[model samples]
Target: MLNYWIGMAAICAFAMAGVLAAGRRGMDIIALLFMGVITAVGGGTLRDLLLGVPVFWMIDFNYVWVASAASLAAFALARHLRDETVWAAILYLDAFGIALFGVQSIDKALAHGFAAPVAIVMATITGIGGGLIRDVLAQRENLLSSREIYATTIITGGMLYTFLLAQGGASHGASLCGVAFTFAFRGLAIHFGWQMPKWLTLRH
Candidate 1:
């Protein structure tokens, strides 16, 4: 139940962030809606498909409507904001959405009897798959292609969540800690322009 609501919240954040990204490209409202819906559901869709489960939005239909509504609302409000503000909001919203989706996906996988490694991988897909698609559609540089500590934070948090659960920590406490650490880590990276260590990145 809590996980369900957390998924919905992630959908809302991702949808709005998608709309802003598409709108920045001067896309039409229809295009904006398409991007929003895709970004909101893309990650979970991939995770479910890989997990051999029914796609969540298909099961709940409410997810689609919520993403659509949030996208349109964001589109309407974004027109009044500056580009700098829009980008900042997108980063923060994306960070928040990633934090929730990362832990939620891990929890889902664990519940499905997957091992820690598989659950961590699924969590990564759920945390960034949408943003990856959105960036491609928006013609923006994908975060994974950069040296930023983006996906690293998601993976780190997923590992922590799995470790805590394995150690018999309370699920609720583990989830909160995972989400908090992911969000704060990503938030700090965004604020401080932190980059991955040179050895951890690639060079042409």
Candidate 2:
């Protein structure tokens, strides 16, 4: 139940971020909404498939409705938000969404009795999967190809959450902290132009 609500919130945040991000490119309302929905559910859908659970949207139509509604709302309000710093807003929202999904994914996996390592990997995927799909569909370079500190932040947050769980911390509070930490790290990276060490980056 907790995971469900967190997932919905993450979907809404990313959907709004998608519209804001694409709107800055002068995309039409329809295009913006399409991108939003993809950004909202791409990650969780993948996570469910991998876990062999019923696709969430299949069992719960509410996820679809919420994602679609958020997308439309973003589209309708895009012009009003046009003057806002779209990129920065999207980055921050993306960071939050990533953190939320990462923690939820790990918690869900552990609930299902998965091994810790697998849970960590699933959490990482849940963090980045939606954004990857959003970028690809929008014809932009995925974050994985950039020098950004995206995946690193996700991994760090997931590890932190897993450690807390192993230490018998309350799952909800630890997850919240993990999400905050990931968002802070990612937001700071964007603000400070932080990048992975050159040796760790691809030489191209």
Candidate 3:
């Protein structure tokens, strides 16, 4: 039950983040809403398809309603927000959404009896797939090329949660720990402008 609610909140966060991140000149409300809905569910949809399971939103229409409502709310509020504020909110909301979704997806994968490595992979997808799609759709610079420690945070945090489970840790405790670590790591990386080492990037 708690995980369900957490999933919903993550959806809302991602929806709002998508709306703000993709906002641009001459974009209509329909386009923004589409971006929001896609960003909110894209990751999980991919994960489900890969896992051979039913898509979550299809199972419960409430997810779509929540995402739509959140997207519209963000759209309405966006005009009042400065670009700086919007970007700041996008950073935090994206971090929070990824953190929660990463651990939650890990739990789901494990429940489906996937191997730990596979679970980790699923978690990574669930964490960043939505944002990646949104960026691609918006034709913006994405995490794939950026130096920010984004996907790394999700992968590392998912690994931590899996490690705790292997060590007999409680699911709730491990989840909280994973989410906290990911959010803090990503948040700090954003604030401090952490970048990948030069060697890690392609040379010009």
lDDT of 2 at 35: 82
Across 1-204, the per-residue lDDT of candidate 3 in tens digits comes to 976786788788889888988989899999999899888998899999999999988999999999999899989988654477666766787788789888878888989999989998998898778878999999998778888788999999988999999999998899899999999999999888898899988998
CA lDDT of each candidate?
Answer: 0.85, 0.79, 0.87
TM-score of each: 0.89, 0.83, 0.91
How do the candidates rank by lDDT, highest first? 3, 1, 2
lDDT tens string, model 2, 76-195?
Answer: 776665554764665676677788778878878888999888888888777777778888877788879888788899898888888888899997788778988888998899898899
**C-alpha RMSD in Å of predicted model 1 compared with the true structure:** 2.1
Q: How many residue pairs clash in each candidate?
A: 0, 0, 0
Measure candidate 2: CA RMSD. Answer: 2.7
Q: Per-residue error at 146 for model 3, in Å?
A: 1.2
Pitting candidate 1 against candidate 3, the one with the higher lDDT is 3
Q: Please state the error at residue 86 of candidate 3 in Å.
A: 6.1
Residue-level lDDT for 160 in candidate 1: 91
Q: What is the lDDT, from 0 to 100, of the residue 155 in candidate 3? A: 91
